[model samples]
Target: MAKTIHIALVGNPNSGKSSLFNVLTGLNQKVGNFPGVTVDKKVGSCQLADGLNATIIDLPGTYSLYPRREDEWVAYRVLMQQDKEVVEPEMVVLIADASNLKRNLLFASQIIDLKIPVVVGLTMMDIARHKGIQIDVAELERELGVPVIPINPRKNKGIQPLKKAIEQTALELYKAPVRDFINNEALAPAAIGSVKELFPELSDYKAIHYLINHESFALHGHLQEKIESIEQVNNFNHTKTQAEEILQRYQRIGSILKQSVSEPSPLKKTLFTEKLDNIFLHRRWGYIILLAVLFLLFQSVFWLAEYPMNIIDWGFGEISSWLGNVLPSGWFADLLINGIWAGLGGILVFIPQIMILFGLVTILEDTGYMARISFLTDKLMRKVGLNGKSVMPMISGFACAVPAIMSARNIENKKERLLTILVTPLMSCSARLPVYTILIGLVIPKTMFAGFLGLQGLVMMGLYLLGPIMSMFVSYIARFFINIKEKSFFILELPVYRAPRWKNVLITMVNKAKIFVFDAGKVIMVISLILWALSTYGPKEKMRSVAARYEQQIKQHPEQEAELNRLKNTELLQNSYAGLLGRSIEPVIQPLGYDWKIGIALITSFAAREVFVGTMATLYSVEGGDDADENTLMEKMNAAVRPDGTKVYSLATGISLMIFYAFAMQCMSTLAIVKRETRTWKWALIQLVYMTGLAYIMSLIAYQLLK
Candidate 1:
């Protein structure tokens, strides 16, 4: 066992920080929330040039030390050790975008002055060269008094050199600057000198920060009192001092970049990104392009998943049939075949869709197009009592509302932020994918539309559409009811488009699929097994009476054996515990065109909406027995018959169900996350009440009109 060198990688957004991380850690990274915060903290292990293990923490990207958003604060806290839990960084890797050296150096300069050992990993040198910009790495290094390594993580160049620099810096082979870009003593002499007495080890730069954010630092009694007294005596002004500090840093950085870098004359060329954004960012056409992109995304989920989904469905069916034939016919065999395999298969079949959806999303993100979506949607968001920042969480809700709600912490406006959290779940998350895909396939026609589009795919697009439309409508109404007057703003950066990294895309696809299969699979399996038990056994006397009644009927009317068996299964199901509960609640949901089968699903899906398909698979398998092997879940659901002999999956019933799931607060994980983020059950309960009520009303109206 050996100690690992702790390193923090800090950079501006779009500085190729994440690309470098991916290259360093590959699939070795683990993502978790920072202690007591919802923002993600990504950690990974990589071997240094000296063959020693090192831990790399990729901090949230930020432009400066002052933080307006929660993510920015996370980086600030770790760098400042504002929390007791954060591991102290032995070395800081400042990733500078070579293409944007001037602005990048502003943050780079800030870190060097923090008195920590630093190694500057200069990235995008080729991009800078392509733009007719040249950087004198030696000059920049000499000016900043830190080791500068030119690296391209994408091309796997200079990584060894960067690692070597980190190792040397950690070993004190490279010395940090004794004096940084700005003279802190000249700016705040009294406060800096006084803070140094309280903490002898404090650098002039560290003392300045202590003066500015001393309230956040771990200080007690006389130490804190002395710092406050110094600030008061010197008339320290935070806003004025920060502005002065930034101006001074930039002034010195500007002079250094002036001699060290060269750029082409302005009249010679324009960036290719600007040329592309011209059309993609057009006021009128931008909206149209965004709509088409979303249309293709939802359509692709169904269009691309069909082949793999069919394969998975067939594969699971074969396994279940083989087990049934090989194992003796009994409760254990029945449980393995119908209970476990059926539920697990129903959930697994949708993994293809989940992977494809997430893969495309990751591509959009890596290529820097996702930011454009948020930028384009800002106007529409504001009209709904939110700013463009809300679009990030809203789009994230398409994957899952729990993370989406957590992301809303970046929203500075309390009213808009809360509104975003409350309405985020209305976006059709992938959990609802199984429910939507199955229902749409069962009820919607399989015809082609306009020569290429499938009707079922179009129906899925429609299901996704309901999420944003209803979210806007809800946000509009909510804005009027919940009054808060905090001003909101939207400032987003659109990074230059680049080829998406296929490796990152694959990783995201695999991770999302694994999470759905392993995480959701666990819940679906336990619940399905419970459901199998409830649907299999009931009160002893009632079960005996049903068995006796069916046995006599079968013996007396041998010619009617086929029909008798169907009745026997149906009657037995009705007498079972789940059946009794479903029947009791059936009257309440009957008007929505739901039968006991759907009622049971509704109850089970409260654990998670993805469990809906699992519940159906188990129910249908328990009732069908060997028929379950020949017919897929969708086929079985489509052919389902009610007591009155009508098809259970009528178009009206399917649409009503889709509408309900589209708006319902069906995910306990989402509800729990909401509680944790909002810090009170009050808002969570309000969210639960309003969302469930809306789902019920919308479903009631849809079923009544369509049926």
Candidate 2:
């Protein structure tokens, strides 16, 4: 409490930085936005053994001091404390991967030159050992002039020592054990002198950094003017200086590694990762394995969640029936039991499937197989005018399109990045799951194929793939129209495989479920109440006429009173606000086999694709009347019929609806994000028109052919 120690965790991509941060801070982490950037500011606080608290900022994973991407700039800025959103760190915790020490040591050496006290948290020691690499931690520490504590955050080992190192280093003002990694006096000493003269109170390393990055640094007005003058006066060449410094640093790093680390003959043995990659990354089997993995994922989403979903459906139905019987018969009671609760129940029943999807995804990411997925799909990406990096946004699109589109910023190629953003919405996100689940249940027969794969699951997986498949096709066409000649680059590091960290997986599942319940659940509830109100009320004159007509017919034909009642219910719905709204759009969607009720759901679901289930639940429950019936949403939808007595959800209509959702940009958030990411309504508006037109054409064809 007395001293707020700020520790910044820095490392290259796939260096176990995230795992270490998660272990160090646990649930104390909070995500916020950094100043002047979209990059997330991840800060967490942990209590040390001596009751001291440390705030650790997990800066973006970057390779070196020189910034290239926005994320790298974010990391660079925070380390320099040039931004208001970041605190000046008391210590820098460099997460060096032991298996890839040569490259990691390069970045660590750069930070040490920054002269901000540094402690290296060495990770992946086990993987290093497996690869027949031995590291003398104490010797490496002596050479780097910092504490190189070997820790496995995934296994919860050596974390206390990491914290202790952080605490002790903070007390000593991050004094490095070895001080100078390279003789800065020889490398760009003249440029350093020019910088140090202007900013008299800077370290040798800091002065050189200023000389290299002076144009981009936070210096302003007269100070900036002086730096520019100094640059011109000294003819400070950034490229030449950078290359020279790298050469010198590596020369010394080579000597340090030769003394402190030993590696077995590479020809001696094969690694477990190599054995696994043989199948997973094979030219032919790799693609087959990828498809199988995807098939299983979607298949399990249906099969595994089936029992839990049925229980939730049945439980909600019982509660609705019980409430209908117990509460006094009134409009308020009807709304309470049917409108709000039923709508909510529809969304909640989908939690199991959502949890399963995120859980499985977390496992893939933990095991480092996600990178392979990107790698495998790179060739396909190139066919669409994108490269391997584009796969990340497309993969993230399976969760939600907004963040997925934001993630497109990682692709440095402007043309490829824009195309990625434009098509990312084609990936069927979790928002579309509700629509998929209900329709799959209604139309896809619960039959097994090849003994293990269920027919319904196959349908589900096909629907999921529909979006991305269409996206690639769409991009192939769009590339010719929007011409931006830019080179595509993709350099990926395949991380060493490790066991799935169950705690992280569980945390991801729980967080995703909570987001669905608390965030999406709120939207569903509001729309449900509004739909209930519209369906329950009508124009005063029209309502009175319909009611009087129905009453007279029922009295005149007592023997056919049940038919009259059904007609009366139908008439009331026709005159109601919701019904009229649906009727207005019915003609357009009717060709796709949707009736007025389905039309209403289609309209409301533009707010969110998942709202279709909630809208269906409320509207159907309202039409079923104030009776105690234990019918699930699927059952009620199945029993629904038109005025002429035809079924509402025919196989053609169900398939058409799924096809429509798979292509349509029905999510407002996605559009907003598109506009934000592109920095204009021009691109987002074009995307909306393109996607909607495609959806309409596809759905029309599907219905026409199936019907």
The most accurate candidate by lDDT is 1
With a 3 Å backbone cut-off (N, CA, C), the pairs that clash in candidate 1 are none
True-structure lDDT of candidate 2? 0.80
* lDDT, candidates in the order shown: 0.82, 0.80
Candidate 2 Cα errors over 4 Å, as ranges: 32-40, 173-179, 185-191, 211-223, 309-351, 389-466, 478-488, 514-573, 586-598, 607-661, 667-687, 700-707
Give the Cα error of residue 256 in candidate 1, in Å: 0.8
Q: Which 10-residue window of candidate 1 scores lowest in summed lDDT? A: 622-631
lDDT of 1: 0.82
lDDT value, residue 115 of candidate 1: 85
Steric collisions counted per model = 0, 3
Each prediction's RMSD to truth: 4.7, 5.3
**Model number with the top TM-score:** 1
Model 1, span 1-707: residue lDDT tens: 55579999999988888888888988888766687665667888888854578899999999887776667878988888676677888889989999888888888888888888889999989889989999998998899999999998878899999988888887799977898779867888887888898889878877888888888777787778888999999998888888888899989988998889888998867789888899889999988998898767766766787799778978998898799889998889989887888778756776786677778777888887878887888888999898877886787678667556765765767788889999999999878987887788788889997899999998898988898899999999999988777556676778888999898788667765665566546755776677678878899999889989989998999998876776677677777887789889999889999998898888768766987876776666533224454247778788889888998889999999999999999876667667766667788899999998999899999999999
